[model samples]
Target: MEQILDLETDRENQTAGPSGRMHLGGNDLTVDAGRVVLDGTVVGYLYENGFLRSAREQTEDDEDPDTGQWRLVDDLEGCDFQGTTQDGLPLSLPGPSSPGPTGSLSYNGRDYQVMQGRISNAQHKILGEYYGGGRFVLRDARTNTERRSLDEGSVINFSFAGTASDGRDLSEQYTRPLYRDQISYHENEIIRYFQDFDRLDQQQRDYVIESMRIWAASGILQIVRKKEGNAALGNVKHGAAGVTRVRTGMVDLDAEEFERDIDLCARFGPLAVITTRVPSYVEVRVNLVVSHEFGHQLQFCLSQAAQDRIDELYQARLARSIAKFPPPSAYDGGSELVHADQVMHREFISGYAKASVFEYWAESVAAFSFKESRKLLRQLDPGIFSILEQVVFTPEKVMSAVLCEQILNLQASLRFGGEFGKNLLD
Candidate 1:
């Protein structure tokens, strides 16, 4: 037999029991007007067809509670709430929730993994205090171990055994060896030596080390310095001119040289070389040039299929730029062309990106290293962002957690105090 209940009339005429509480399915529900009150607090409201819209949970510290945390119970039967807590932790009702009264919690820029409602640090050393009712007691300072661990593997191991492709060991040529005994992590060794490496100050050297760590850790053949180069700050190339020689099987050379080159087609990586007496600029430009050259290194190291995808994306972006702003006839000089390129490719990170597909990619990589440019890159071309995230930023590719952390920290730092990429093209 089918029984139909008149929900509208029932709700309008619904009244509380003598004690101001109504009994519904063994639960005491207080019906005050159209609201369902639980223990003198309004939990939800009765709607048409006897449906109850559950009220959203509120945080004690939220200024706008209504917009902060909300859960929607779409159906009266077999419905659950799914939303985030006030602390931005994921919240799901009914069973097996996150932070489960004894789990990790990230609050106010610190991580706490608690057991039995007690908070602990990374080394699992308990602070001997319980975090009751969502209250946290943060440590005054991080331990030295914790601080050092942040950049543990950021320094690459370099072996000065084999001679550079230039037929001489640049390390011996330079009087002052800047990074002779600075081995940090136990990853694969790359043959690297700098010429005139001591010219830069400590801060400049630190920036160079941090910026180049990701590429060096990802199997780049070498990091060599050349005393003479064509006015360029840095460049990446295949075998014979840079740090390590890579056998691409395209050119036939002597068996001895071929034996030395690594044979993995995907791993036939390029060598990165900077001028011997490279001038130090602002930190932003220093990081940008190194990372940009490594961007070319990354292109050579990638598989053919991955390279094809990048080419496809570049062509698509180029078409969009051409469509947006057609090229003008006559230009005064390079400045006019640069200005026109900036307006034409407003979606790109910089005007230099309009040079060519390779330049576009290199410029994108350089910009993606900084905080402000990364945000703008995501906004402008999420395709490039997704591609870079998959290929360059993964732990499997980078192979060092410390190097990954260094890249993250470099990305977090703002260039020019957030006025970055405003009028600058480089």
Candidate 2:
């Protein structure tokens, strides 16, 4: 029981009478002037002159009628075509040569022939297609579908070569090559990760930056993650002098003296900002510390207040402890010498001088800039106020009268304009 479907056989010359001929499954079929053979089974026995026909189910009109066409349920309800072969096979339909369905594709340096027609239905494409050529149809190996085209060279390379149900020698050409794009998906994933990072709003970014500052001050500074570690970083320094130094440790400072400590150490441009590790943490507090350090730098950059303050503190210690320091330079500016009854001698002496006279003046400026900052810390934690009070005012001292007035004037001008003194303090 071998069923053979031959191409080039005429329909009138064919004979089907269930005698001395191989029994093809589902009735004897033919194709393109060739004898058709469905080498499967024949169960349902309904015959006219021992030649039989089986009805096929019908499908929706939108489907490919050739593939979608089906017989009525009643037509095949009791039909049991005998099983001629366990393997599914197709046979040629008796008629003039007609294309089964044709498509051409090239892969792996070889051309292929696809027998299944291009899928016109969207669903079929989603599920994929099959391959066909010669006398039979086979599954498309490239996309793993029934409606796929195969190039002979590609098919052999992909390992697909055999006879289809139609008894036609299939050329490996019907199978498409498995082509994969490696870079596209990888690039997409990278972009997606960056987008996820970007999706974080401003508040989240700020929180992260704040945490970094805390860790840095707490002596935990190190490269947690360097995006471009080997790239040259511009030269910058954190010392009082312009010298490069890499930091690797933390320092403990009285949370009270955070601003004071940072101010004493910071210098403008090329100087590192000062910060200290504290046990209790708050993003706002760390932000205040950074503001204070930069405040020192801004003051130094703008005026001579820093040098002046340093001189004053030094002279105070000299007068009390050693008593041989030279007297401060004479008040050289044309400003009037105005002294208050409660002002310290140092204040009177310094205030009578011009605005541009001393180095400590920069410290005064930084202190002025940090007033609101100090208040913010106090609002967050009141204990920080005592630290501020100790540095600026005490039982044995008063700030230089001129420095104090300058600070007050700077505040007034900023808050209420240059004509601020015209109004009473509210």
Candidate 3:
């Protein structure tokens, strides 16, 4: 673990960590002229948030041969921090001022190197200067001033999780990426934008983060800028924005993937009714892909021992439920998975859930994690809802206790019971 160096908290002279110095307090950490100061050093600058809107890094001398313009660096914030207009078109702002970003990024076999860069609002380009094999420095993109940088100590991989999903503990399966992706962001405009977002009405932005950070922690969603496309692909190709591997907790949601589906997800409103673009026979595919993928990761992290017990519990519960109420003698024999409004909906959240026990558990797990999805599941089948609540979630804790706790918290706002009980709350 990188020791959090503090002037008062530490006994010895401290060394800067990969993130350098950090000023952390809940809503009290103020920014002046875009920098965060801790102890006496300016750690990192802040970005201003506003309406937004992409591009590359260039040096002072690096010029576009054809256009005769410097190759403009991608304003990571402008591409990231966005909003929508009253007419519902994308609104890209150019105001938030920021120093740079701190999180690590993984890419195709190599981590991008971090380097000192210049950001100029005048030229609209970030000029990074990285030496061949020496240490890197970061600078304010606007003023061309070198800023302090933090060094990371270690990237911890989980050690004790009982065992692996397969036969043995596949501890060696996922090797943490050592290489770093070197990039910088514009400071002045982006920093100003971020500092002002809390003051602006959320509806003003294209996406308001009421619970996005909390929600995304499920699989540790890390969006990377590898390539741009309408679909997401990594670890394997899925024509979607996000992919979660059962073997490893590493998840990737392409920026384009979120961009493509968010509007559709919003269309369902309050309910966020899922509608799929997968061209399947099922009438709709919910925008619960994030929730769905999180389910897969949670289940994947479980040891074989834990999985066996979960299956045993589900089977026993299935037998009891079948005795109380029989399955339809006539099978719908549908090709794609489906969710219906009728009760006793074939002991599955949807036709998709019926494909297999794993799929059934995953679909219900999503319902277990989300609000609108859970509502739909309960309306479709109370028994299955109970099953998801008890069997799967109970086992899920063995893998990710924190994630399960979050789901529990997220669902706390909802109330449910029998018909009269439901009316009582309303």
All models, RMSD in angstroms: 19.8, 31.1, 21.7
What TM-score does candidate 1 reach?
0.35
Residue-level lDDT tens digits of model 1 in 1-426: 000122233333432111123333355676554355678666554321122344544343322212434222222235433333222333232213212234444332235444433344443333322233323322212110111111221222221122222334222111113333434220122223222225645544554454444433332313211111111222223222212324222212233322222221113222111122223210111125545544554555455566677778878867765675444443321111224224323545554455566666766665565444566677877877766665443423422332333443222111101211222222
Model 3 per-residue lDDT tens digits across residues 204-282 = 2333232122222221221111111111223332222122223333334443544344555567632232433432213
Could you tell me the TM-score of candidate 2? 0.17
Query: Candidate 2 — worst ten consecutive residues by lDDT sum?
Result: 224-233
Query: Residue 105 in candidate 3 has what lDDT?
Result: 21
Candidates sorted by TM-score, best first = 1, 3, 2
**How high is the lDDT of residue 35 in model 1?**
52
Q: Which is the better candidate, 1 or 3, if ranked by lDDT? A: 1
Better of 1 and 3 by TM-score: 1
All candidates' lDDT scores?
A: 0.37, 0.26, 0.32
Off by over 4 Å in 1: 1-195, 202-207, 213-287, 332-345, 395-426
- The backbone clash count of each candidate, in order, is 0, 60, 57
Q: Give the TM-score of candidate 3.
A: 0.32
Q: State the lDDT of candidate 2 residue by residue for 1-426, as single tens digits.
A: 111221111122232211122224334432211122344433221111111323222223412213434221112323223221111222221101222333433322223333232111211111112344322222322222222222231122122244443556554442222322232211222222122324445543332233223212211111111110111112222222101112322211223343333333332221122221321211111222322223233222222443354445535533432132222245333222322322222221222112222312222222223333334334432322332232222201223233333333222211111111212111
Predicted structure 3: lDDT: 0.32
Instruction: Judging by TM-score against the true structure, name the best candidate.
Output: 1
